[model samples]
Target chain A: MNSGRRQFIGRGGAMLAGLAIAPGMLLYDLAHGRPASGAVRWGMLIDTSRCESGCDDCVKACNKENGLSGGTGPADVQWIRKLELKDSRTGRGVSLPMMCQHCEEPPCVDVCPTAASFKRADGIVLVDRHLCIGCRYCMMACPYKARSFVHEPVHDQKPDVPRGKGTVESCTLCVQRVDRGETTACAEACAKAGHKAILFGNLNDPGSEISRRIKAVASTQIRADLGLNPGLHYEGL
Target chain B: MDLLQARRDTRIFYLLVGLGALVVAAGLVAAHYMEEYGHIVTGMNNQIVWGMPHVFAIFMIVAASGVLNVASIGSVFGKPPYKTRAPLSGLLSIALLAGGLSVLMLDLGRPERIIVAATHFNPTSVFAWNVFLYSGLFAFVGIYLWTMMEKRMNPWSRPAGLLVFVWRIILTTGTGMIFALLVARQAYGTAILPPMFIVMSFAWGLAVFYIVQAAMYGWNEMELNPAILKRLKNLLGLFILSVIYLVAVYHVTNFARHAAFERFILAEGGIYPMLFWGGYVFLGSVLPLFLIYFPRLGGKHHVLVASMLVISGSFCLLYVLIIGGQAFPLSIFPGYEARSSFGDGQIGSYAPSLPEILLGCGGLGVSFLITTIGVRALNFMPRDENTQAGD
Candidate 1:
């Protein structure tokens, strides 16, 4: 009877030990090593020539996918929107979608007091809604004017997309969608019309479409002199 | 109780309750009308996101920092005038904070959920620390007023006064940090703002006290001796000098650097140079100095005018900071640098809309209303054993 009791206790202890070790092993895999380099440095390239000025299909897709209230308005809470610019000298017009550039040295991240706004290992700049105070400092810090304050209370916020009142928000590069092995709303919508103005892929990978296009096209980062090194690039600007 | 005491007490209660009710009513009217119409009714837009609310809120907050001199006078330096008035000063600080926060709430989109500001704290944000510090200061001022000053001084008074003294300095620094920490903006992001804010606090606080005292003494049919007035004027003169020195240093350094930002600040096309020199530095600081320092002309009327201008100019300084910062947009398109947004694009400019102005005016009303009631009810004006208090 004593021998049987000892065997039962030892087995229970062994199971507990394995449970403790499992999380650490997972952490290590996520931190330093991943199979197939699942880690991706997400980037975007926009071809302004192909983008239609006022067609807001990407904006609509983002709003619907995020389940944002219609009252939020495109002007106030723009995750993506088409900007029309008129040249003073030539009177020429330029149209393109504007969103977070996801800068390599994002000013918004530098000024966030709680470190709630941070760049992911894959170079996606995101706001942790749980930690935002809506002080609007990040809005001021962002040179791209990419951040927006939540001015109205939202109802029926999509469970997949975090939302809160009295908080600052901006584009997350569609992190949730990326986790599901899907493209961003803007990219998906733009692709349907065979326009594909926005190309998203890992900049580090030489074989990726983004890398290839970047090499081939005359592209530039918006306000590169600011030294933000934004991952998003504009082709034929 | 005696008839005189009975009448005084009755008058105090009525005014206090009446003013409190009025503030609440005005708040409701503003929140309802403004929110319904959208912030468009106020002078604000995407171009100038903040406006009068920010100016008024900051003014009251900085004044709250200044009111601490009352405690400092009593304990830190043992200055007789402020030392004796310590308790009243503590209460006044709380009153200023209440007025300021009321303005902030009226400006918020979700005033009902302002608690979210506390629940969510972003460490990288100076505004985040401001939220925390403002709340902490409010609580500290409240407790200090109630337990230590409301009654008479107890053993806790000294320690409470010391704690408050230190906290007020931090509060002012945090207020300055709101602008100083922003590296992107050249107008405010210098090491100079923190000290400038502290000195400005002294000028503002003393000016407020002088005006209130003059008004209160007149109302009570009491004579305010010229000696006391002279001392107040002297302090005001000193603060004005310091403000002038700081302004000169800040602008000179910026101009000397000759960066694009420096040109933006000092140049004619930008609004900051106009506001800072024409309105704040020269008009606000220098004009007041002339009024107070020209010994021959430094009479009561001169001192009063100088103080009023300084007060007005201080407010203009806050406006210039907020508006000037936003005027320069970030997205300066390459290969086509046609002077950025304001200089070329005509993208956006802000003017405080009606609701914005009304809410801001209401904030001033709230401050005065509180000061009046507090003076009447709480004996805010200190009692000289040789004379009556608030009479």
Candidate 2:
């Protein structure tokens, strides 16, 4: 073969190897994801007026996404719950979804002996599976009762959401999807259900849709008396 | 007196040790099963994360601190009678702590991963501080015990005892703060809890000491000195009254800000009310006082009965405080009536399963086993001075 022809074949072989390794590198990037940026403080604003009391699309979406049993039993782990409330004096009825508030100073993080319950710089609260001793001190400390211990063995977990028995778990704000630059399963599902009540975005960006809407309305954090400064808010509640 | 009597004593000792060993083995097996099946086999859930095991473990832990007060009276306060009982007091403290800690460590969802607690510490966590406090208690108390037991170390016992005395208060404070530091819970979160726990420890620990001391004396067919008996019972009576006083203060203070919680704990909560009023107040406190202080009724057996009631009362009070505290619904929305699928605003329920009970019993068994072995091997018995209280 001519020298020029041989060089061209070698180049072609190198191109083939590159094609094979490209997908692997992309997967590696996905596997060991870049740390969530400090610039973005993610938050949610719920318009209770638009939220239907009977609708449970948000809950179902979360269960499906997180691979939870979604059972209503006392032992079953659930990330979100819908609360029905009636004012004692005025007889006014109200309804809203409840989950981890992802506080600025989370009590769970404060009480966890092993620092397993932690808050990311971006304000996402999470349990480090490797370190959690399952003492459930966080469960006791939480005013909202948002965290749940895995009471039974877990099976058929989503590959992205690795769950185990004998560990405390709660909403991660759909971290897997969030890391992939997608909105939470619950918020997406609620939007799909035509409620348009659940809005998720970066509160730091004043130009973002959630920020503009929050600015336009009076939104209140649940248990504002606690001064948890939650990432989630409610409007017209 | 005879070979047969000594042989009989050995047989009885073995029997007691065997019983304790059996219980410990069973408890360990139950814990193993819980680890295998997950907490699904246990009655504890997300709402009531702690159950019978915590009750037993906490009781032992709190009482362990209180038991050391006997030694403190001798070594720290320079009391003659309390000084005589100091060695046995030290032994009980160590034994009880061992049992309590064992149950606490084993009950974790990931009991095998408990080393993570030591490796990754959160400074803000009361539980983490407790870890250090508990180990410190063992170290300091061990040193204190050594000083008391060793001839050359006798002079050091006073300082060691002083250090242990101070460390134990901090340790008990850490235990009480486990609940007191919680910002949201109504049953806990009171500044008064640490003091309440301290007094409670005194009563509970003394009651335990009485029972054990009585047992040891009975085994040797010896009579407790009348003056020592009188002083101990009177001290117990005072501790009981202190406990009642603290309980009243706790309720009254809570009533002002948290009327609903007060209502739930005091009256509206069925078991809670019953446990507090009937179980703790009447049976554990009042009846015991009557038995201890009643004119012409201050027999040894009567005092023993009073101590028994006090011990049971401690359990009743703690049950109301710990389990009942969790049972009451959280006032997430103060003015609004709330309902939810996740038991929001509804009372959290718990019924301890067999494994949970066994795990707790196993912790007690561990204490018993250690005490039995320690008492048998060591010169822990108290010899009557044949003089009065001040002697």
Candidate 3:
């Protein structure tokens, strides 16, 4: 009876000690800022109805952020662009911003020879500049027409975006800012321009603004029949 | 019968080699310029990424695999008539592949990062698989040639030849999958492409072989046996017919599933339709068929003319398939007309510049130079006891 009581006390003390260390471990993790996990899936919800025609602020902002300027030729790079769509049947016109769809099963990733095209755990698709061999096979595989091959040598590149010639690039959803716990440049620009058309947030979090909007509204993917499960969803396509 | 080395100390041979080397040098210069400046110098833009260089590179690579079929027929099938020609077939496969691979490598935007491609591999990519298949082809063909030439190694010739034949099929299939596996393109995403490429390799490869054989005969001041010539011409005709049949089936299938793509390629596809009908069908296929069949109209030069037509037609087919496929606007927004900063919903245009043309021709020059050197070093000429008896 005495030994059993001592064993119970010992177990209770060990449990108390574990409880004491748990809060400190969590505080350390919070202080260090743990890397983004797969549990948080980033996504975008675009309300085309709210999008205004001839408003290229989002495109311009993306360019400024990514340092894509001075060349607008057919061969020049365009990470994001404003697309005007006119319905053939209804003759109704609408404008929207187009960029990489960031599919869960990205075809670009599948066709890349050097595994340069990849998707991060947080659902952001990116091209690894170091690994890219500039074969353009990924360009051919991309259905969204989001990718662009750097045909000429770039000058005055932003320090954050290290773009160079002979490599394929695409919209990274402002991954640098996202990593720093901020939204994409396009989304911020859209909101700043008094047009809250683009909403960027964590899709996995039910409480996130984008996720709530998607659940409340009917959102459509560009080519939904392809079953790519794109992270970018659109209302009023 | 004894094998004899070609005469190396000839003025004509030296002139031919010099001309080939000059062309290859020009190609290298063009590649250097493109690399130094950027792809902006080329006609290829955002829409049309691949251009003339791909057409030439793909053709040579496909033909390289096809040419090896001759040796396979000899060693694998034990065909007596084809046995003597196996050595030349093996040599041509290596030479043509080297030429094709050189063009493909030079056309890369980051050719310097070739080591990255070699070291880092993505198993899903057909291009990555092709790197392995292409290098393996060279090694296998080399071993196959060695087995055929070396007396002691002759015992293993059949097995080596069989392995090469199987490898070549996979190589051509991978090449076809490069375009076909893309679900994004309306012109691609079909199972027919691999088989079509296989048949194309057969036709194009045979055409290359016939031309080389004819040239070797001319160089030796000899004539091919009438029986052998007849058999080869008939085989070429059959291969051409097979290609025609495959093309018809592909169009019919596309018409049912992708009518828009079919209309773009077949009916209203400006240069594409013309190239397909006039170049590939009429001049490449139908005309060759007539020459091979009629014989009287083509006279003694029927084989040469037919082979030339086939080669020309192949170039046309590849151009239409590669360039035309890219020219058609991508269907990003179905049922809606799209306008953007990029050329969305607009037909893209690509005109091959002088540099691209020079680079393309350099591949041919490389093959020619290699062929000349190979024949000069070793006896790749076809020999027939029956022909000597007739002489």
Candidate 1 DockQ score?
0.19
The better-scoring model by TM-score among 1 and 2 is 2
Query: Which of candidates 1 and 3 reaches a greater lDDT?
Result: 3
The model with the greater DockQ, 2 or 3, is 2
B189-284 per-residue lDDT for model 1 (tens digits): 678888888888888876666666666665565665666566667888898788778767876786664355556655654567787778787777
Candidate 1's displacement at residue B52, Å, is 1.5
Relative to the unseen true structure, what is the Cα RMSD of model 3? 8.4
Q: What is the two-chain DockQ of model 2? A: 0.68
Q: Which clashing pairs does model 2 show?
A: none
CAPRI level of candidate 1 = incorrect
Q: Write the per-residue lDDT of candidate 2 for residues A1-237, one digit (tens) a residue.
A: 699998999999897787677854555565787778788999999998888888889999999999998898888898998888888999888888889989887999999999999998788999998899989999999999899999889989999999999999999999999988999999999999999889999999999999999999999988889898899999976
TM-score of 2: 0.94
For B213-290, candidate 2 gives per-residue lDDT tens digits of: 999999989999888899888988999999999999999999997888889988989888998999999999999899
Cα lDDT tens digits, model 1, A1-237, are 999999999999897787677854665556874432336778899998888766667777878888755333322566665676667677666777778899888878877766668888888899887665444667767767677666555678889998865566778888888776778988899888678888888888999989998999799888777688998999766
Whose DockQ is greatest here?
2
Candidate 1: what lDDT? Answer: 0.71
Q: Give the least accurate 10-residue stretch of model 2 chain B, judged by summed lDDT.
A: B382-391
Model 3: docking quality category: medium
